[model samples]
Target: MHATPLTFIGASVSWGKLRSAVTTWQPLGVVSTISVRAPFLNTIRLSSSIHHTEETDVAAIDLDEANLILDILHRFQEELGAISDAGDRLKQSRSPEVDEYRRRLVNVKGELKNAAKSGTLDGVKRPQTELERCFYGPAVQHAAAHFRLRTDAPPSMWLSGLYDPAGDVSYYTHGLRKLVDEGQII
Candidate 1:
């Protein structure tokens, strides 16, 4: 499958420090923006013509897949939040060893938020590294498994197997093979 690219725009923080007779505090507001582009012309596709052939089953499968994707996205978001929280705590503690970790975490968190704002997490952007791609493979495979297909089955096979013969048989199969050959898939 073709993957889209994501571009980060900018980030901003709002709010000012408040000082009282004996204490000072600041509440920060961070806003990040990004743009998500799809490699495919269409973001979503449905086989309407064949719906009548197996409407109920197909609809159920689609719903299950959608829910699975949503769960994965939620988990990803939670992971990012945990990373950000950990960084914030480390920064507050002022620990020497955590200094480097904090910086890296903050940077990664920012990038992730920017990507999310840009809708990249919606499956628009293809992962830049094989590791990242593999990280998300389980989620894809979960959806496929719900459809009673092999975990390594091409995504198109689980989605619209008959309609996109070329995609299911050639592009996806070849892509998987290439990934395996290059050690991108394990």
Candidate 2:
């Protein structure tokens, strides 16, 4: 009997393998692989057929895979697309490249969070509020307080939705759940 590979391997590894398969192998310049598992893409393909230079006729995608793609797209929309208007300052500018960078950051955060939740990373949650989206919440006060005590930084700096440069911020970014585990930051 034939077997599906994913039956033995976990979803996290499946995602990684998919990433590697797509990234490591560079295809021809004219070749493109658009994995549009979303049902709405069929509608879009139909509506925008006039603008296309080449015909795109591929086998119908599996519904389960389509649902997964739809879910991830929804998550991305929730996490980034809505907030794209006011953006992540990657290199002091909000360009398309910066937006792609932020999207990749979110993807890494999601994948790592999924893979390590049972052991390595714990007590981690998705960013809910706008401030929490850009700035680490627990680290916010620590960095702000460090700036306050050391530099005598004014309260307005923190109040104005700005980030202060502090070393402890790394601790918050990398090992946030550990902070909660050790009672370091609540």
Candidate 3:
């Protein structure tokens, strides 16, 4: 039996030979280990352990082991003509038409902001009405019909779309870049 040693603060440790050492390791919560072997690559092996309380789960994954298993699996799947990859999944989830609509909404918002800055009531009203008609009206109606989300959903909910992984990655990347630029990250 291969033993993976784990330690807990305040837990008694009799650090010595395995034969003589006493292990008082008790389940802090539900404890489980999952071992995975890749069929395509006999060299690939992975073991993941998860410990959890009623509230939270703590996972311990060896990056090297996990990577080896994933690489093998990916290659096997590719060879076996497995289903679509991540990019395909992303494309399937995001409709180009929906993205176009979102882009138009963003343009409408910009127009509305410009109108407001002009400080003329008529200038604001026309663009505001156009925005409501062209963007929010159809969006709200669609959400209500399909997802049953309220027409009056919060601004944040309206601003955010169904699935935009690229957008999320871009947002995070921009934040990281900003941090680097400000010398907050090294």
Candidate 4:
């Protein structure tokens, strides 16, 4: 008897997805993975007849659609600060600033509705530095509602929870959580 090797991609949505598939491996089936980051990543691969590629969509997102929504949501920050700031009561009594924010808020809300109708989601790498975290933290908050998920609805944050603002930080939302339990990204 001859042994053949099967390799799994390291960047799958989650290890839970591959748990059952790996258990079915026979002695002759050599399971292998290529990973430099996560030691245990890349352990699941479909055999020649395990499943079709389309099935993987269950773990993936429609980037175009989610990106549109996310993009619009965060754009509200262009004038002064984001709507999260408003929620945080960061908006001052100055009439001009308040009015601008109100105007932008209405605009962004309508746009987000359009985006929800229009589409889904894709993966985003976790921020590693303080500045990166600070910058993306708000985006994470803006996009957090999309995280809980719904049938056929595009995901908002596919990566691990990235924006848990500290009590001392300016914002207060819980932030985005992992879409998959484990193994979504690096």
**The best candidate in terms of lDDT:** 1
Worst 10 residues of 3 by lDDT: 13-22
Question: Ranking under lDDT, best-scoring first?
Answer: 1, 3, 2, 4
lDDT of 3 by residue, 1-186 (tens): 433333122211111221211112246442322222222222221222333233322222223322232233233324222111222333434546445434433432332233234222122222222222322223323322333222233223433332232232233334434444565421
Worst 10 residues of 2 by lDDT: 41-50
**Alpha carbon lDDT of residue 99, candidate 2?**
49
Per-residue lDDT of candidate 1, residues 1-186 (tens digit): 433222211222122232111211112222222121111121212111111122222211222223223333343334334433444454345456455544444443333333333232233443432222332344333322222323233322323321222122233234444544565422
lDDT of 2 by residue, 1-186 (tens): 431111001112112113211111122232232222111112111001111112332222222322233343334333332222333323355457654544543443343233223211111332222213222343433443443321222222222222332343444444533433455431
Q: Which stretches of candidate 3 lie over 4 Å from their true place?
A: 1-33, 41-43, 56-69, 81-186
lDDT of 4 by residue, 1-186 (tens): 432332222223222221211223223234432111111112222222121133332222322212222232233223123434542453234445555545544444443233233121111232122212332334434444433322211112211121221221223111212211233322
Model 4: lDDT equals 0.28
Q: TM-scores for all candidates? A: 0.25, 0.21, 0.20, 0.28
Clashing pairs in 4: 62-121
Worst 10 residues of 4 by lDDT: 34-43
Q: What is the lDDT of residue 150 in candidate 4?
A: 24
Candidate 3 global lDDT = 0.29
Q: Model 4 reaches what TM-score against the true structure?
A: 0.28
Model 3 residue 164 lDDT?
A: 33
The whole-model C-alpha lDDT of candidate 2 against the native structure comes to: 0.29
* Per-candidate RMSD, Å: 20.8, 18.9, 22.6, 16.7
| Clash pairs for candidate 1 | none
Go through the candidates in order and give each one's C-alpha lDDT.
0.31, 0.29, 0.29, 0.28
